[model samples]
Target: MSGRQAVPSVRGKPGWLRRLDPLTKGIWLLCTGLAVMLTLSLTAQLLWYLVVLILAGTGAGWRLKQWRLFALWAMGFGLPLLLFQWLMLPVGGDEPLWQPFGSGGPALTASALELSAALTLRSMTLFASSIVYATTTEPRDVVVALTQQLRMPDKLAYAAAVALRFVPLLLAEAEQIRRAERLRRLTPVRGVGGRLQSARRMALAIVRSALRHVQDVSTAMEAKRFGSARARTHWRRVAISPAGWLFAAASIGAAAATLVYF
Candidate 1:
């Protein structure tokens, strides 16, 4: 099975974020992400991350449990990247701070730590922005906003939505495969080489399964005459309100100011 499932849906009562237009939310996320990418200071990225966290917590009502899994996943990758940066990216004139494996190993230095922190914090900022947008916005709303507000083709918007919706189903199918293997006592090899072979087999199985599912979905969509019409009508409409525009603009402006001045 894949180590993790896909995107999460909102639970319980809907919040204010649900009422806002998906396009506006998307713009806010994009602007912040760009600003975070351009900024060089760790402190600036940290501050932007805090702002995003607050919005996610207060407006989105994101609980600790929902975030815990994602945080662990982020740390799993981010920590290694951080270590790599610290060990390999330092300049020649950097002062040695500590040597983990005595004089034989590369010395940890202040410059390395600063560079690593900056890079990691920027990545974390982008992650937070994405999570907030994904958790709060519905796929249907996004499709509607894309088709109506952005002038996107109906075929493309709905296709993207279907692909996203397929993610969880694929994850579940992979998990089921793993469980069935375990039930049949089909243990793979014990050595590293054997593990790689086992992983390759599992991956191939998953790809085949996904291809089958995609074919089924494509057939179903074709049967429904999905793209026959020049224009499609939506059951729901999403339009940006005055408040949503104001909020998006403010968020983007704040990020730009911080990027330039901070």
Candidate 2:
């Protein structure tokens, strides 16, 4: 089967971003992550995130549907972090924007707002870039590129591929477990303690399922004599196209510019 067929998560028609070799997309992700980490300016961080969104929209064919989940995730985590930084963190100016409880109870300030915004934007950028890479790149192609082009060990490369492929499966499985519980008329967990118990039970179930699947995969690999040979042959050959090279170079240049200018 083709690499694309092996992973159902990598759906949708191929686009410019999806056509690039896994190595090239990996490099782009790495560069984007590093650039976001090194960037301190809020404006620069926002620009980087916008550039990633544009790439996802134009190159990866991402639409409102694709962005909906991403937006939810970004806001779910970003807003809390932003508020935490602004309220709890002790890294802001003395001029209080809003003193909630008299003189000294988590007063908001301009510097706090700026710092929180930058940090939140940086996190959101990394999150969005990761989603783009994971959605566009195929797990089997990642294995091929790593083992063939990067000369990584076949065992290690396959492990990485399995990780990439199983994450979504595990998530779906957890959701299914939740739905099953709901269908059985299980009472919804109320407080923090009850929620933690429910979560713990769900995690245990997922872990057990994942372990069983891993055992099956291990058995199949052993039957095939995986990692027996010093040299490995890939079913699919992955090579960097000229466009991939250009994309890598452009990403590196942009990362450099972000580091230096911002």
Candidate 3:
């Protein structure tokens, strides 16, 4: 990560979104994502994506940095799917909408283009919804909701919570490893082969470190008898007010209606 710059955290304005039940947000994202995937309708997907954006921007108080992150994520994850669908998906009897620059090969068709757009939109919609949910919800709240409201197994809930909490730690560890390598005068290799070798080395180091960390966590949990109790009491209770339910219902209903109309 030499020459890699530190990313500034873009803090959103404090809002009631932080107070919303994690379970409701989870359900909304799940329902909306599934609806988009099932409908595979370009219009519905686009609309859903826009709706999620508005929710994140207005309700969650998104700013320029968040929007930039959203765009970056879309390009990274959605663009490849779109390109592959357009280039490789078969289009029988459909008129060509585009032709590649060289070799005079099979041209792209309206059907293929439409399919590509649908796939891209579906993926982007899901990704955007996840970003909104994760940014707005807290990990502890999610774990509590899973265990208390959803009646998930205590061990499973704890594991999920720990995994979510590990994300930032793992990222920071990777950065530290990179910095250490740079301190030792190690840098990214220039050529494709060298880069691949460097990547392999880095990956192995990260994986080994992660495994050690996981082992330590497991030992610590076992020592603490984390799941020994038949029933555990939470220090903090999460209650979803009537208003929260109404908000969730409206969002889910809109998504379902979109699917039905499309």
* TM per candidate: 0.79, 0.84, 0.79
- List per-prediction Cα lDDT, in the order shown: 0.76, 0.81, 0.74
Q: How many clashes (backbone N, Cα, C below 3 Å) per candidate?
A: 0, 0, 0
Pick the winner on TM-score between candidates 1 and 2: 2
User: Which 10 successive residues of model 3 have the least lDDT summed?
Assistant: 1-10
* Cα TM-score of candidate 3: 0.79
- For TM-score, the strongest prediction is 2
Task: Give the residue spans of candidate 2 off by over 4 A.
Answer: 1-8, 61-66, 178-198
Candidate 3 lDDT at 17 equals 72
Looking at model 2, the pairs that clash are none
Each prediction's RMSD to truth: 3.9, 3.9, 4.0
Candidate 3 off by > 4 Å: 1-13, 61-66, 101-104, 167-209
lDDT of 3 by residue, 1-262 (tens): 2211221111346756766888887778888877888897788878888888778767676656445645765786788889888898887678777778554786798888888898888878876776677667767888899988999998888887777555545544666666677678655558989768766877898899889989999999889998888998899788888878988898789867876799
Candidate 2 lDDT, 1-262, residue by residue in tens: 2222322246765678989999999989999999989878988899998999898877775545445645766787999999988887664556888877778577888888888899989988887787678778889999999988898988889998888777656755766777677677656669989888887988999999999989999999999998888897667999899999999999999999999998
Best-to-worst lDDT order: 2, 1, 3
